[model samples]
Target: MRENTAEESARLQSAAKDHLWLHFTQHGTYNDDVDIPMIVRGEGINLFDDRGKKYIDGLGGLFTSQVGHGRTELGQAAAEQAAKLEFMPLWSYAHPAAVQLAERIAGYAPGDLNRVFFTNSGSESVETAWKLAKKYFKLTGKPGKHKVISRSTAYHGTTHGALSITGIAGLKQDFEPLVPSTIQVSNTNAYRAKELTAGAIDVTDEQSLERFGLWAADQIALAIENAGPDTVAAVYLEPVQNAGGCFPPPPGYFQRVREICDQYDVLLVSDEVICAFGRLGEMFGATHFDYQPDIITTAKGITSGYSPLGAVIATDRIMEPFLTPGAMFGHGYTFGGHPVSAAVALKNLDIFEEENLLEHVRSNAQTFRSTLEKLLDLPIVGDVRGEGYFYGIELVKDRATKESFTAEESKTLLHGFISNKLFEEGLYCRADDRGDPVIQLSPPLIAGPADFAEIEQILRNVLSQASAKL
Candidate 1:
């Protein structure tokens, strides 16, 4: 990779500090700390900071860069499409790349999700899904069905509609007066089941899976009842809730959720922003979990973050209302279905197939799980959980008692020790305080057993250091 000149690096850093405001960040800290990080290049699964220091991209570029970075094909595809036809709005005028990518995504999406509405990012995809659900209900003469539900501790996005659907309270306190019809439900974090269950999972001889599944799935039904069936338009969910750590759906969980949604006359929106596009060893995370949603919201891996792209794939039933000759959904963005992004996505999907990335993740997922589970020997690691290339290591105060950190301990340890140490040690995942102190990892889908071990070794080293300080 070509290196950034001293002059160029200094100029960019100055501009970033002076003008470019970072999102979901603290601005004051960058003033006196080390130089602002400028990731100049990336390849496979390694990222190079501006100073040319290399680090394993442990979190896959905020859980987006599944196909990895610095792939020349993605760049070439973008350039070729831009040169030919740069900007054609998905509004009245449609372009080939957008149309083609939509068809491709519809084909890959499970069930009857045949209509694709493109957007610029995950937030927009989420917003699109919520709007479609509400409008679909209105069109079907159930205009009273306007409320949406999601699990607690999940992070949907920053847009108002998406933020309203988010489950974290601390993040939304400032953004009050958000879209006024969102509800929260309990998420499936089986590691914390001791509180809900009288004892452990009871993974004994016969009903281990059955027992866990029933307990977890009931939470959604309970929430639906509390919210009242008539008012709920949709239930938005991630296959593995990412915010409160990666809590994968308990066995048979989605099946039960499906039944409840159907019974309540609610749409099931699989918000696959983090779990989609081969993160879970499949085109859609819904496929990995064996559930068919009425709508699937996706972004991130669609183009491997080469360019911005998001999509809301809805079934014909939901879309029919908006396109019945005269009626219009009346919602869209100029850059939502950018031809360049669509072209890049096509090439990204091509690379996924040619390299067999999804299959690679599926074949090696067990190794990833087993290697991370080995960290259980460390007392601080209470739970090592997730699926496919995505996973989270939940830290705790005690293993046997399933104790969690105090508020001060969470702030000091997660924000102070774990976050800094991991970065200092050249690993770039997350030490999240959103739900306990967890070291989250979702490397490129192409990673294998060796890469998993590399991640484990890094965590093992840093976490042990963190545990000692605590």
Candidate 2:
């Protein structure tokens, strides 16, 4: 890729500043002095800016590029499919690409989750899952079971239905009157177990961790009963909750949640928008955790961001009602399963198998974890927790007291300093303040020890400066 000329770079920056609307971004930040970060190209877990400055893709392009970048084959797959059939609506019709892709995903999904409903993005997949849950319940004679239960600080998506299911109050307050009947329960953040569990369990050892897991899982059951179990349709949870900086399920957490869902006849929806397609060293996060969800909502890594696609994979039981003669779910999107997108997804999966991407993640996950854990030695670093190729390094005001930064301080520390500094230091990751302040890292599955070392060095330098500033 050629570097953008100074004039061209300036022109692109001006155009972006004038027209581009970045998601969840404060546009005001880009002023006369600060230019919008313009990424020109990507290859092998690295991104080059318009100015030709190289940086490690520490967040894997928002946790979407599982197979890294610059794979010409995925692009070729899209081109070939488009030449054959560019557009084919899945409404009242079926395409070979969609059908074959669905079958491939079903083969990957655990248990009886064999039915795939395609969408254009993760939010759509989530919205589709909730709708499916409600419709399935109504078909099964439980018309009132339409409510959803999710974890606190867990981010499902941005659409009204998915937003309603999201537990982040800040993200929902702007869009009031969301789809009702959604409830929030405690999440499985073992680092903050004592507080999240209301002092019910302090995670110090395996025994206490299990106790905390049970306590957290029991919260779902409690919410179900409190909301009237018959009125609750499903429970939406990410295998590793992403919004709160990659909070992995504690040991026995999902097992107990599965038992609870089974006991209550509630559908368990595993929202794997960020956890699927080799991110967790498994095709589905449910498989990684040894649990079976009634439905799995996935996107992002399916095509490695070479194209747009998403899916809501449900169990055979969830599909049983709609299979009856003349029965209809009455839900779909225009570009839900675009043939080109499906073709790209199939090629992406082929790459995964051919390269053993899942095994690569599994074999080196510990190295990734231990590499990030080295940051824990810093006083500002409170906790480094996650699984597979994903991880989060929690920043705190004081390590001894576990005191996090206040809202204003967090804004200054994370957004004002850390975010920009990390980029300037040649690493692209998230310095988030969604819950407490933390740095979230989810490099591509192809990343090895060398990549981890580079990430660690960048983080160590920037975080040490952040600590000194505090």
Candidate 3:
């Protein structure tokens, strides 16, 4: 590994401090005492900082890098496409790469979800989904159905419509009086089942969990009824809820939600921004969960983070009204389906097939779960829950009582100690305090038992020290 010179490092740090405003980051905290971290390179499932120190890419570059890193094939594909056609809009004109990629995605999507609308990012995809839902309902003569339903502590995106659907209050408080008529119901955080269920039912055993799952699913139905079904256009959900940690759906959760949506004449949208592209050991999370959604909004791993791209895949039923002559959905991102991104995604999907990445993740998921479950021996680890390559280890103040950290404690624990400690110990995962104090892990699909061990060891050390601090 090549190291940076003192002057070069200082210059980079200076430039970052002067102008680089990070997303969802507290920029003011970076001072002389607290220097900014600069990741200069990545290869395989590891990242290198400006100082050339290597750390495992445990979060898969914000749950995006599915094929790991440093694959010249993806780079070459991007370069070739860029050389041929650098930029093009998806407005009125269609490109070959986009058409091929769209057809491929449609083929993979379940049911009649064969129509694809490309977007620039996950947020745009979500925005498009909501807009499409409203427009679709209007054209289908359900014009009153303009509202959306999502889960509490869920994160959709940062845009106006996406942020409106996002269930995290703190994230939307500043941006509020947001796009109106969005409602939030309970999430399937089975670990917190007792609290979520208001102690109405036991959640200790498998049978009880099933009951909890049904109850959670019923909340969406109740929300729809309360809002009046005619006013509810769609329900947006992630197969495994991302914010507030990876909350996987309980058994029959999606199935029940699907039934409720169908009964209410509402759309079920699987927001796979972070769960798609083999992250959950399947092409789409809905496939892994065995439910068919009316629409699937995806991005992140589409190009393995080689480029920015997202798409909303809708079923035939939803696309029927829009197919009429002179009827149109007035939504399109300028770089929605860039040729280079589409090319990179096509190549990324090829890598997924050529490498059998999906099967690999499926075969290794249990081992990954067991490896991370080892952390439960630590007093701070309240729960380790998720599916496929996605998991979240929730930190608590007292494991026996399932007590969580106070806001100040969470701030100090997550940001001051845990986040920095894990990175300093050479692991690039998330110590998120968005909903709860939890360490989120979604390594590259290529990561196996060996990488899991490295992640376990690093997290073990950092979390042990964190527990000691507490």
Candidate 4:
């Protein structure tokens, strides 16, 4: 499927408008008649562009294209590990596809997570799990336990120590003097849990949403007793907290946040960088919420995005003070665990175990959540929440007084009209206004139910024409 050329699409949109600089772009919303997006190719869950057009990859590419996107067997397992050992680097050396993909991601991690470390993204596996939780409390002596905690709008990445454990104060207020002792708290947005309990719980009672998930998991034991649990070491979360959208985890939130980080000896971590490998049909969204963390971090679908990788893993009592003998945690990452991104993450986890694809996202996660809760009979769809095949809808204006939308009306309804009307109606998702003006969807855990009825009929005709323009 090649051969589409308007003089090679005006010389690749004139070398991406004279040199592209995208990431988190605004880029003056592209100039010479707005071009940029580009894309080029992809397969299974679709994609294409550069004149070929197609689309429907509805966010899996950002939520790293699971087993989708033209899987030429993960590019022939990165060209047979770049013809056997292409750039090995897990410093002090190691290879054989990064020691068999870190013993197969420590046998699919959970309890006794069994070390791993590697990194290259997911903000260098959350800046190497906050520098291995401040050097595992300075090699087990608790050298004033290097403070950290996280929640509010969540996110956890964009480097500077995962952007000071990111809680989204406008994406770290223009990266301000960061890398300080972090802290944030209160996230389990059980539909804003009665405005985070100011109305003292009862967001439509299921025993007041399990007492608002045990007061949002006792706010990380009240931020480790107001930062004095030996100056706290770690907390960082996200086994389903992506930004402020896909917020799941409420009822008994992460088992009361693993009993308040095991009664405040802190260190829980589990960032899952977009809910780990299966995007929540559990490979580890902390065992799809059964809880047991210590450190997980991860990267966008391991090698599903074919090459770059990331990890952290931990446990085995946080790698027992870096395996003693002349101990060291003085981090690393010159393409951490490279060897062709650990042989394309051990052949993208052997195509998620020969395409069981985590039981095809656990048997179609409740038909992708009742087909996105049938767009909540739209009035700008106040909430649809999320879980497997990760979701989120939010968008409001008054779905019976849930109100929302005014940061200039959610920047004119999610960036001036529902993200260019759901990519000019072909579907590549996410209209995220960071927190509230949601949309999100995370397609391609080999999306089914006819791709969730063509993503709920293109989000019910662009949210019923964005609820008739409010």
Candidate 5:
């Protein structure tokens, strides 16, 4: 990695501060004193900033880089595809790259999820899924079924339809009067089982955990009944909910949710934007969790973040109505399946198989979990939850009582300190308070035991400092 020249760095800083509008960013934080973090290059599991400082990519580049970074093959694939066929729309015609990539995804997706609809991002995939669900019902004579049910704090996407299905109120309050009839249900966060279930289940034992799982799954059924099943079109869920700090579903949770969806004629959508493509030690999170979904919305690792692409994989039954003569679902994106992106995705999947990345994750996931669990010895560490390479270490003010920080404390501790301190220490991970203050880690699937040790050490140092301040 080459360091940016002083003049080049100044130009970049000026252009960024003046012209660049970062997503979900607070631009006010940047100035002469506070420089914007400018990542200039990546190789393997590490990233190099403009200043040439190397840091381990603990979040897998926002949980998108499954095969790690700086894979020239992916870029070459994109170039070759762009040279052959630069632009084509899926509106009325298809290209070879899109067709091939869709077929490959269908092969990897679980159950009868064989129909692929492409988009440019996770939010678009989610929006596509909701529209498909509604259209499917309308075509099947249940036009009234347009409502969706999702878990509390589970983030689906940022587009209006996907945002409506999203359960985070903070992210939605600013964009009021969203799509109507999206209901919230209890999530399977076992650590918060006592609070989620109102003291009915504490999750002290396997039996109690199973009971809590059933209770949480039952919440969807209750939501459906309350929302009027006739008006419910689908229930969207993540295999492991991401927003509330990587809450893995309790055992038998998805099975029960599957049953509920089937009983109510509701489509089960597995939003795998962040969990697909070996992130959870499987091709799809649904496969890892052992459940069938009527639709699966995914992106992120599809092209390993080398290019933007997203997809909504639907079951054959969901596509049956639209397959009729002259019948159209009436939805499409201009860059839904860009040839270059599809080619990149195809190449990315090839790397996954060639390197046995999924197998690598499965073999090393336990080691990663145990390494992160070592943080429980810290006073501020309350719970460590998640599956595969994705995990979240929840920080509490009091470990014994599991008392989380107040909003101001969370802002001051996480945003004000831990986030930047972790980066200064050369480990790039997320310090999020979307649900509670947690250090979210979703390293690349290719990461091994050595990488986990490094991650744990950095986290230990920064979190120890944070605890002292608290």
Candidate 6:
């Protein structure tokens, strides 16, 4: 019925159910509901399922494919690098690609961030940053500085150390008793400013961006105080917190955060796993936010998902302790600086520069924002917020009241209705039920007004239909 040869579809379904352990999926849903989307190919911003139906790349392959899919250049880069040097370790010696990429990343990083530690993916990058922060503090005679502070609803990574820093309770409950010494605090959502003058919040005037920034930043100081400044090693923050639905920091938020971190002698780690590499119209989210973090953990868009490569960039001050002869950190991944992956990353960065992808995203962010904001014409759209192409639409039961859906309502509405309906209608966005039942859109940077229009139209249709049912 879906225009696929029965045998081909059967083969895919069998393989999916038997061998695939999909991430963040309820495998029981496959009992008789729907077959998993077997995307065999992609071109530009469209994915071709095994049945040949094309869906818009609405989420940019999980926020990793910045330059879009089916890029022959990237594929060729990987292949060429593999043929020349299939594998190499960055233990004692480094490869050309890795060395070049490290230098490029260091050059691109702001302030004194002149050191890079490569890893296999964003999760590893997060772990590296955490370990480096803890080690840096310990080396500087602050053994008590071992705790990390992140925001509620923010996801740092899935590894034990990184997961400890992650604030999502759902993701960590199963893996409880994780590495201790992690704290969670309120995130900056100016849209939800409760009391602008109470509990270290002084940004109460409506739509006051600066006040919101100050109020939000004060939360970090509170966290540091509550946790004891001597026990806080670093504050890991994402320029645009994506899990809580792309909550871009209010103006001056990062600057204030940087100040608080420095005033407390705690390192600032910008966890830009999802926000870096052109997702926010800049090489890094810190650049977009106009602040300099002491350490930056990044992955996802480095190779545009062609190959796995993550880098933990550090300020010269932080790396100084590590460079004191024979201070081995004893941290190295087997494939951290894989020659092939590094080569692919280098090529991806080259493509970014050649295409002026950052500039493109910057020029078109306004259009993307305006197009998505059009959804506000609908009754259910409460807030349309984010930076650059990364955005999220927070839904509300009553616009005037800004009442949100209950957990049961969220499951039935977001998971049971809008998410499926949108995908069925040919858009691959996220109908997230995490903090709120928000629809998140982080399309590829290559997208323009047309792509944004398509996303908006699909969201409008599905969200409107779902809201009507609710």
lDDT of each: 0.87, 0.93, 0.93, 0.84, 0.93, 0.87
In the range 1-470, model 1's lDDT, one tens digit per residue, is 66788999888888899999888778776874556778888988899987788889988998999889789999999999999999988888889999899899999999888999999999999998898888888888998898998988899999999999999888899989899989887777777665556665654333665577677677777777887888889999898999978988777889998998888889999999999999989999899889989999999999999999999999988877777778888799989989999999999999999999888888998999999999999989988889888888989998787789997999888877888788877889988888777889989887777877888888899889877886
Deviating ranges (above 4 Å) for candidate 3:
none
Per-residue alpha-carbon lDDT of candidate 2 for residues 1-470, written as tens digits (9 for 90 to 100): 68999999999999999898998888988899989899999999999999999999999998999999899999999999999999999988999999999999999999989999999999999999999998998999999999999999999899999999999999999999998889999988898998887787889999999988899899999999999989998999999999878898888999999999999999999999999999999998999999999999999999999999999999899899999998999998999999999999999999999999999999999999998888888999999989999888899999988899999999999988999999999999999888998899999999999999999999999999999998
TM-score of each: 0.96, 0.99, 0.99, 0.39, 0.99, 0.96
Overall local distance difference test of candidate 3: 0.93
Question: Can you write out model 6's per-residue Cα lDDT over 1-470, one digit (the tens) per residue?
Answer: 25568798888899889999999899888865678878788889988887888899899998999999989999899999899999989889978989999999888888889999999888899999888888888888998999999988898888999999998998899999899999888887666665333534444464576777777788889999999999999999999998868888877788889899989999999998899899999999998878999999999999899888899999889888888987877798999989998888889899999999999999999999999999998889989999898999999898877788998998988888888889899998888977877888888889999888888888888888977886
Residue 462 error, candidate 4, Å: 13
Query: 3 in model 4: Cα distance from truth in Å?
Result: 26
C-alpha root-mean-square deviation, candidate 1: 1.8
Which candidate, 2 or 6, has the higher TM-score? 2
lDDT of 4 by residue, 1-470 (tens): 88458898888888878887778988888888887777788889989888888889878888988889988878987888788768967778777878888888889887789788888878888888887888888888988998888888888878788888888888888879998888898888888887777878757867777788888888789878987999888888888887879888777788877877777788888888788888878788888778888888887788878777888888888788788899988778688888887888888888899888999899988988998898888777888988889888898899887979878899888888888988888889888777778888898798899978987998899889878887
Tens-place lDDT per residue, model 3, 1-470, is 57788899999899999988889888888998778998888999999988889999999999999999899999999999999998889899989999999999998988899999998899999999999999999999889999999999999999999999999999899987899999999999888888988898768898999999999999999999999999999999999999999999888899999999989999999999999999999999999999999999999999999999999999999889988999999878888999999999999999999999999999999999999999999999999999999999999999999999999999988988888888888999898888878999999999999999989998999889888997
* Candidate 6 residue-wise lDDT at 63: 91
Worst 10 residues of 1 by lDDT: 200-209
> Which pairs clash inside model 5?
none
The candidate with the higher TM-score, 5 or 6, is 5
